[model samples]
Target: MENIDKRNRLDEAPFQYRINKDQTVFIDYEGKQVKILKGKEAEKFIKNVNAAENDKAVQLIMAKITGNFKRGNERKKR
Candidate 1:
């Protein structure tokens, strides 16, 4: 696992970051991480977030962890 700086303390923090064995950084929220998933990760996350056990609003907090998610708007539309 790899370590990354967190905005708030673990208790106050909402998101968790993990570095997979493949050296890819992942952000954890709503019981899932934005890691090297093949398919359905994004869709699953959006679908089951409400069923997660996040007390401190992990979804809201995870949204702040934008570094893990790639920026799509950066690329020019075809």
Candidate 2:
């Protein structure tokens, strides 16, 4: 499962967090270290992390990196 936190949900927050060789991320929320996975491991991480606010943060990050945030159905309307 992915680690989803309130910070991740913010659109103003940075998306490309540091990439450590150890594959662990240290988020300063919840007062504890957190782990963020990449590549195939990311799929599992998504399942574990689920905070509504955090989800929005992640989506914004993805949208910014991808240049847009329209869902499949919404894209079709454009």
Candidate 3:
């Protein structure tokens, strides 16, 4: 079997976040909302995201906030 280049898939960032006027943070994955942060948590999340050095860093932060997603048992959508 040939070695497949899976780096492209890892380069794709599926996580996104938005902050509301009331300082609530909304975390989304693949265009769907998954987590919400309010009050102190929202403030801390904003600070961390802003301090992230790159897209990959931001993705990592979002992934942790949204809980474990890389269990290796996820099936690819056809």
Candidate 4:
């Protein structure tokens, strides 16, 4: 039953993000990470990212473009 869903809806915000000095970016979805980089490289990477990871990666990228992504943990500081 659980194996049915290969991907989840992009219903929520991104779970993680990272950017390298080379401008390569990475996003996390469902405990997995996907990388997006320079033109040709990015295209290839995107193809291998899988639907679920791609969804979250695109969501995070869109948030960055529109300035909607927020950083830091949601939990209260100890």
User: CA lDDT, every prediction?
Assistant: 0.47, 0.41, 0.79, 0.48
Which runs in model 2 stand beyond 4 Å of their true positions?
Answer: 1-53, 68-78
Tens-digit lDDT track for model 1 on 2-76? Answer: 133243334545466554565444666534655443235544444445565664454443554344453434553
The list of candidate 4 runs beyond 4 A from truth reads: 1-8, 39-78
Give the TM-score (vs. native) of candidate 4: 0.31
Model 3 residue runs over 4 Å out of place are: 1-10
Extract clashing residue pairs from model 4. Answer: none
Q: State the weakest 10-residue window (summed lDDT) of model 3.
A: 1-10
Steric clashes per prediction: 0, 9, 0, 0
> Candidate 3, residues 1-78: lDDT per residue as tens digits?
013224444257888888999999999887889999999999999999899897777877787788876566787667
Candidate RMSDs in Å, in order, are 12.4, 13.7, 5.2, 10.3
Q: Which of candidates 2 and 4 reaches a greater TM-score?
A: 4
Candidate 1 global TM-score = 0.29
- What does the lDDT come to for candidate 2? 0.41
| True-structure lDDT of candidate 1 | 0.47
Sort by TM-score, best first: what order?
Answer: 3, 4, 1, 2
Deviation from native of the Cα of residue 18 in model 1, angstroms: 1.1
Cα shift from native, residue 46, model 2 (Å): 12
lDDT by residue for model 2 (18-78), tens: 3466654333222323335566555433433443256555544333433433243532213
After the best TM-score superposition of candidate 4, give how far the Cα of residue 23 lies from its true spot, in angstroms. 0.9
